[model samples]
Target: MYIDLAATPDFKRSLFNAIVAPRPIGWISTVSASGRVNLAPFSHFNLVSTAPPVVMFACNAPDDRHEKDTIVNVRETGQFVTNLVTWDLREPMNTSSFNAPYGVDEFELAGLEKAASVKVRPPRVAASPASMECELLQIIDIDPVGPGDTFSNVVLGRVVALHMDDRFVDAGGRFDVVRTRPLTRLGGNQYASTGELVELGRPNPPR
Candidate 1:
């Protein structure tokens, strides 16, 4: 059945998350200018460019006039880190998703250890398999829905540095993603983990 998104109600809008199954979670960590730390998860995130290594995540404002602490921190310091979420860190990652008040430290709230970042002010999750330090590029605002004043902000950032666990590196220097078993979000309240391995080669026509 074809569904008209413009006609759909706000409650039904979340169905898009189900339609786009198994999205990778961007467990982002940011630090306020005053040194307060914030950690949160966003499934509306992915790598948008590889030439210069950029990633993006969509963050919805808490209300019509104010943004979330993550966005505020990102805007304040112009830096953030994406900590890869894995099956092992699922609990802490979930805990970080809480709507903690501004200036609240989600790292401490979630009981996760923080590691110093090489090129950014924000710290990375020490137990995460990988982390990418990013500098803010821009925040694009989405148009509000009918009668709604609040909108989502798409934050684009250029990856400036990366941290990876030595255990996940291979002899050939390739990072083994399947072995890391990254976690993903599914439909409402559902989550999943990487379970199987598959290899597929792209078609190579005569060059």
Candidate 2:
């Protein structure tokens, strides 16, 4: 059935969330200027550029609170790290998603080891297969739509450094996605892992 997002399709939980399909999870970690650490997971995140290396994630205000710890910490220090969540670390990553109080150490709470980043104050998850150190580039506030009436802020960060697990890297020095087995967020409480692969040859231009 054809439905218009602006008028036809209702802003229901199933419609909006499922429409986005499986989104990559970004396990973000940040540190306050005073050295408080915070970690949280976000599904509304993706790589926006490559040449300059940038990524963007959306952080919404907590359901019953003002804002999330990650957003507050990034705004305070302008730096954060995006840890790639794999299937193995799914449980601990979920633990870090709780609406904990400010200054709460999610790394410690989730029983995850923190590896100090080379250029950022926030530490990366040592168990994660990959992590990107970033500096806050921009923050855009999105107006409320409907249903929950929740607003979100998009944060764009410039990646300054990247760390990857040696096991996931090939001898040629390239990251192997299959070995990484990154976890993805599905609609509702569902989740998925990296599946099979298919490659197609580039079509030649018409003469």
Candidate 3:
């Protein structure tokens, strides 16, 4: 059956996210000017460009709370880190998703180890297989359209440094996907991991 998004689908839950399939999860960490730390995971995230190494994530305000610690810290300090969550660290990563107080340290709360980032105030997750330190490039507020009238702020950051576990790297200096086993968010309360790899080449070649 065909249903317009404006009409709203009568399913168990909104199938939009599920229909989009597995999405990369971004485990973001930030530190306030006063040294408070915060961490949260977002599935609405992806790498935008590679020339200068840029990534972005969408942060939707919960209820009427206009300011989350992550957004506030990034805005105040202009820096944050995106830590890659693997299947092994899934539990701790999930713990960081809780809505805690502004000054609450998620690392301590989640019982996870933190490693200082070389270029950012926010610490990276020591358990994560990889992490990227970035500086805020832009933050755009998306206006509500129709239906539930939902909106979110898209935060773009430029990567300045990256840390990766040696175990995930091959002798050729390539990242071994199987070793990384990055965790991804599926629809609803589901999650997935990278399965296989396939390569495709151009059908036509220039003479």
Candidate 4:
């Protein structure tokens, strides 16, 4: 059956979401100007570059109540930490996604402790397998075609520091991806994890 986003669903669902397949979740943590910390998960996130080590996450339109706490705090402080969500921390990661009031601290809400970040004001998750401390580079707010500045906000950050769990590091000092078991979002209400490894050597350039 063919679905039309322009008319049928009334812009409720977009085929782009499911067709994109699995996406990385940026488990972001930010601190308010008043010292409150907000932790939330943004599935619309990924590392954009490796040279300067930049990461980005996109926050969609705000709810009727107010703007999301994560976006608000990041704007106020200009710093945020991206914590890796392992399979073990899935419950707390989901718990942090709850929509709470502005000053509420999601770290405590999820029963997690805050670890001090060396280069940023926001703290990292104490139990996370890895984390990236970042400084805000830019925030691009996509203008909505209609009304409101509520389309989407894209935030880019330059990684200033990194934290890794020693156990996940191999003998050669390389981080083990399969062992980390990073949690990822799938279509609908589905989720996935890195189970097996698939290695393929790139083909040589055509003559």
The TM-score leader among the candidates is: 1
Candidate 2 vs 4: which has more lDDT: 2
lDDT of 2: 0.89
lDDT of 1: 0.90
Give the alpha-carbon lDDT of every model: 0.90, 0.89, 0.88, 0.88
Predicted structure 4, TM vs. truth = 0.92
Per-prediction TM-score: 0.93, 0.92, 0.92, 0.92
Tens-digit lDDT track of model 2 for 1-207: 766566743545565567796899999999998999999999999999998999999967887777777888889999999999999899999999877778889999999998989998999999998999999999888888755656789999999999988988999998998888889988888898988789799999999
Residue 179 CA error for candidate 1 (Å)? 1.9
Candidate 2 lDDT at 201 equals 97
Tell me how far the alpha carbon of residue 166 in candidate 1 is from the true structure, in angstroms, after superposition.
Answer: 0.6
Model 3 pairs whose backbones collide: none
What TM-score does candidate 2 reach? 0.92
Worst 10 residues of 3 by lDDT: 5-14
lDDT of 4 by residue, 1-207 (tens): 776544553553545667786888999999999999889999899999999999999988667544678888889999999999988899999999888777888999999999999989999999999999999999998876543335678999999999999999999999998988999988877788986678899999999
Off by over 4 Å in 2: 1-10, 145-147
Per-residue lDDT for 29-148 in model 1, tens only? 999999998999999999999999999998778753478888888989999999999988899999998887687888899999999999999999999989999999999988776654
**Candidate 3, 2-82: lDDT as tens digits:** 766667634334476898779999999999999998999998899999998999998677774776778889899999999
